[model samples]
Target chain A: MRHHLILRVVTKLLIGSIMLFALYVQFHGDYSPGGGFQAGVIMAVAFIIYGIVFSLQDVQRVLPPWLVHKLSALGVLVYAGTGVVSFFTGYGFLDYAALSPHHPVHGQHYGIILVELGVGITVTGVMITIYYAFTSRTPVMDDEAW
Target chain B: MLRTRSLFATVMLAGVFSLLSALLFVTLDAVDVAFTEAAVGAGISTVLMLGTLALTRRFESPPAHTPVIPLFVVLVTGAALVYGTLDMPYFGSATAPAQTHVAPDYISRTPHEIDVPNIVTAILASYRGYDTLGETAVVFTAAVGVLLLLSGLRRRRRKEEEDV
Candidate 1:
């Protein structure tokens, strides 16, 4: 990794755009072909690419495993919480009308965005967690192993 | 691909196959599926497979059993699948059961109800929110399962090393 100057530089250049594209896909999914799932995977890919180019320790320093694990659970909570909130508002479970009693359509929009955000967070966390788990176990292979 | 013995090459070929399928999905007007297939199936899985390869042998061992029974099973499954499709409607048929089912209502009402430009997102995140919640839970459960198994292995390995 230390000697692979080209790989390192290219990864540094691509990581930012990858993250930005992930955000675009996440938030812009309401109008486009992508959503939380695609965005989350793309976001995780950025960190994974960085880990591959640099080191697992380096990436972990930026996103700790405990935090990643918590994030995975947090996303689920966020999703379920939305439904619970609707229930408390006298609507059926997961009914978006609860979010905006006056304008059900607007409620649907807000609910959709919130749920998508939850999905994106969970996916990003799980993916990075899996990557960390797999990579951390193996002793770093030398550059010539490829 | 079946003839190749190198695990690395096999993994790379699998990635290529995923990419091709993603392209096929795109051509079928299923862009959302294509985007996910391209990102997850082709990208992450390839890297993960390569990581798995690093933890194991680079080349596959020669098969000890004859391919006759496996080949028979595969052929039978393939034939059955093709036969199953024969009873279904043609591709993009207007009168297909799926097309006639609740799809029309969703298409008609989504513009006013959800008002999102992407009906897929509307269905996935709002209309079908309960199902999506279940799906998110499933992903979380899977992550938890993996973490438990892998971390347990590491702990046991460390214990063994300590004993030695």
Candidate 2:
């Protein structure tokens, strides 16, 4: 793969586009079919494809393991923290109405966005982490072996 | 065929199965579920299996025990599942129990209460927020488990270096 010129060139072109599509799926989920889980998997696919074409170390450089680990936890925090905020504002847990006192509808929108963001972030982090975990442990083999 | 096949071939077959099931989901009008099955089952799991193959033997060893008990259990489970489905409503039927239940309330009130056009999103993120939160936590735990398992590789490397 390292010496494969076509593979390298195609990967460079594909990664950016895949990432853009993932973002579209993430944000447009409310109106369309996709959501956080789909977007996250799409994002992970971009990274995994990069890893496959290049080296595992190259992908790691772009997204370090520590950052990946932190992102995974942060997503869950953002989700739970949303609930905690609503609770403190005299509402029940995950009550989006408390977000915007004047317009409860707006609050609902805000809450959905936040929750979906959390889901997206966690999914992306965990999916990438799992890929990394599997690839990193395996001993390298020659191209011919594969 | 799978029983006699190499691990790589078996994995490929499984990936194909997932892709087919994803297509089935799409035809069933479950786009989100199709997206998940295609991505997770076909894409990620296939890649993970390849990496696992890289670490270990490509061919499976012969079974050490009899398959009779496991075969019996699987047959019983399959029979029970088929029997249960006979009593269930037809797929996507309008007058199904699911459509008749509290689903009506969710559909009617979602526009006013959640103010979202996508009722699925409203239900998942607002109405069932806690359930989604729990699911997210489960995903997080799976990542943690894999990391713990793989981190042992680093320790083994260090031991080999010390031996050298």
Candidate 3:
């Protein structure tokens, strides 16, 4: 148990560093080795490692199962909401150029950031949720009769 | 002890190979792909598989004999594919057909069409909106599946309580 605690602390620090690096990658994705999908997965991994080390129940104290479920839905909603906004603005679905005709590039940047955030939220939530679900359930262990 | 040693060896070998594959993906200028592969393939998949292993037996029945015919066919096909790569452009060559063809159109027109600096978003949302929608649906479906499974388990627990 003492060893487990040490391992947990080390993994937590490593996860923190990875998450910070993921943020850097998300922002610098155009010029670097990261993007929305990658950064999202990296963030998910931090939570996954946390779940593995300390048990899912402990991780749940930080991010409850309900919050994860809500976040999962919200993530997709954010992505689709952007498209719906585009549709209502008289542009075809997801046409960000029409978002602001005067400054199209700005519109694109805004749209991309929103979409990436959505992706990040969804990936992180779903990955952690899956881990939670699997780990929370009792494993079937058959005892032999003497 | 021998089994534990072999398990460690297998995991180490897999980790090394996963890292090499991630590097290869990076060299190919598929940074996004590389990132996903490294994170999901090397990191998440390995962790999850190891967790499952912990919950299950380490070893199953040993194979009586290795299947040779299918293995030989797969090896030959893989070799042929690798040999075919000799005629292809070097990794990250800007002049490669991949760079010149669809990518250029997406990159160039994206700024003008959507006015977005990130061509990937432009392509994903506007140019390929349908695919993105499908992906979102798939995620929703997975969530729903989880909910159903859990709810069923809860119902079972209630039934047990009533019986008790």
Per-candidate Cα lDDT values, in order, are 0.92, 0.89, 0.71
Q: Clashing residue pairs in candidate 2, if any?
A: none
**On residues B34-80, what C-alpha lDDT tens digit does candidate 2 reach at each position?**
98899889998999899889988888898899999999999999999
RMSD of each: 2.2, 2.4, 4.7
The digit string of per-residue lDDT tens for model 2 on A1-146 reads: 34989999999999999999999988887777788888888898999999988889999999998899899999999999999999999999999888997899899999989888899899999989988888887777887775
Error of 3 at A123 (Å): 0.7
Q: Model 1 misses residue A67 by how many Å?
A: 0.9
DockQ of each: 0.85, 0.78, 0.36
The total of clashing pairs for model 1 equals 0
DockQ of 3: 0.36
Worst 10 residues of 1 chain A by lDDT: A1-10
DockQ-wise, the better of 1 and 2 is 1
Alpha carbon lDDT at A28, candidate 3 = 64
CA displacement after TM-score superposition, residue A50 of candidate 1 (Å): 0.5
Q: Mind giving the per-residue lDDT tens digits that candidate 1 earns over B27-122?
A: 989999999999999999999999888888888899999999999999999999999988899889999999999999999999998999999999
Among residues 3 or more apart in sequence or in different chains, the pairs in candidate 3 whose N, CA or C atoms overlap within 3 Å are: none
- Report the C-alpha displacement of residue B42, candidate 2, in angstroms: 1.1
Q: Which candidate ranks first by TM-score, i.e. highest?
A: 1
Best by DockQ: 1
Tens digits of per-residue lDDT, candidate 3, A34-141, equal: 566677678877777777676666778888888988887887888888889978988777666556768876666677677767776777777776666666664633
True contacts kept of 1: 0.82
